[model samples]
Target: MEAEYDVAVVGAGPAGATAALVLARSGFRVALIESTRYERSRPGETLPPPARMLLARLGVWDAFSTLGSLPSHGNRSIWGGPEIAESSFIFHPYGEGWHVDRQRFDAMLASTAADAGAEVLYGMSVVDCSAPDADRWHIGLRGESGEAGTMAARAIVDATGRTARIARRLGATRQLADHLVGAAVHYAGPLREDGFTLVEAASSGWWYSAPVPPDRLVVMFMSDADIHRSLRLTEGDRWEHLLAEAPHTMERVEGCRPIAQPAFFAAVSHRLRRNGARGCWLACGDAAIGVDPLSSSGIVRAIRTGEGAGQAIGNWLLGRTDVAGAYERILDAEFEEYMAERSGYYALETRWPHSTFWNRRRTIDAAMRQQP
Candidate 1:
């Protein structure tokens, strides 16, 4: 016999876990499925001050505070010119931001969802999802050990990150604005007392470095796919050469040593063509709309979208048919605002106007303005 749930959330990252947490707290039978056992290191660890309110709303503020995450006071960056600038969060109503261990942070969210009555299923992948009618869904799951099972649900939530797996499988298309990629590497060292993130812009792209909890530093190079390939940035030696371009960033990690092999990830700005709602399922977080990491709002946006998606799905199940449309509209508006802000940031860097990376951004901005 297949277990049944009011909602099945595929992917237990912050968004999915948050949605599950909200629904479970509302007395819904929810299942939060995750592909891994939470052993892998994920990115997007910077949590801005705004997340404080979101965490409190999710009832995990106390738990998150005890996670040993480091506090970030502000950002120091060299963008748009050769001079360095510092932005402080002192006047912000919420206080300091945080730099957390993504693995632990995500695990904490899932555990909290479980504690709130959502069935947290780890080490499972949703291989197939089908709908028998407009109101019911059947999802096929496979375990890490090859075990198979099925679960029925009244609705589905796609929180599969930038891939939009579930929504794409349901016929939605991904509309990409750029092909940005991040080549990141971590270094282990003694904790540095400085709590501000560092950003340095270069002719090719940009560089950012931030201190993680305990004893590590994360540095990444953000560039277009072609730029990354042309420079062979994935090669350790090439990566180091590029790092030298950002003198300030290089100086900050003078004593640190690489802790692991370098990793390249997709950092493109994109959104689903239909805004990720098809029939009984809706998407949230990066799955519905992924923005550039430069925004520094990835996790915050994920939590907000997750909370919104949970509310929308709950309303739909309770006879509110307009929630999906409303959700789509909200996402569309947010994406537009993000695009404008991203363009404004990119416009600030004009030193390398002829650089392919910068040129592409300018061209994209122009195209966006011409859009009706």
Candidate 2:
């Protein structure tokens, strides 16, 4: 016999865990599925101070505060200029941000969801989803050992990040704006007490370095796909050459040894062509809309969207027909605001006015402005 649930959330990141936690707390039978066992390194480890409120709302503030995450006090940037600029969070409403171990943080969220009565399944992947009727969805799951299982759900939540696995399988098309990628490497060295994230802009792209909790430092070079390939940024010699260009970032990682080879990942800004709501299914987090890493809002946005999607789904299940439309409107407004802010930020960097990387941003910004 297949187990049944009121909601099945695929992908146990912040978004899926959050949605499962919310629904479970509301007395819904929720299933949170994760493909990984949280043993590997993941990106988006920086959490801004504003996320404190969201954590509190999720009832995990105490746990998070005591999670041994490193506190970040401010940021140092050389964007749009040759001189470094400092922005401190000392006066902000929330005292300090955090640099967390993504695996631990995500695991904490999944554990909390389980504690809240949600059935948390790790090391499982959703292989197929089919709806025999509009009221229920049948999900097929495969374990790490190739063990097969089945479950039925009244609704589904797609929290699969930028891939939008479940939503795409349901016919939602992703509308990508740019093909930005982040080539990141972690270094192990004596910990620097300074908790500031450093950002330096270059002719080709940008560089950022920050201390990963405990004793590791993470440094990444951000650029377009073509730029990354043409410059051979992944090669040892070429990567070091580019790093030398950003004195500030290079200095931060000095005397450190790379723990592993640079890993490349997509950091593109995109959204679904149609709002990710179809019958009893909806999408949240990067699965619905993804923003550029420059915004530093990835994790926070995931939590927000997850909470909203949970509430909206709960309402829809309780016979509220208007929640989907309302949620779609909220997503639309948020994306528009993000696009406007992103354009303004990119416009500030005129140091390499004719560079392909910078010019591409300018062209995209211009087209966005012309959009009705």
Best by lDDT: 1
Candidate 2 deviant stretches above 4 angstroms:
275-277, 369-372
- TM-score against native, each model: 0.97, 0.97
Candidate 1 deviation (Cα RMSD): 1.4
> Model 1: per-residue lDDT, tens digit, 100-205?
9999999999999999999999999998998868678989999999999999999999999999999998888887889999888998865455988988999999
Worst 10 residues of 2 by lDDT: 270-279
Q: Considering only N, C-alpha and C atoms within 3 Å, which residue pairs clash in candidate 1?
A: none
Expressed as tens digits, the lDDT of each residue in 148-174 for candidate 2 is 999999999999898999988888888
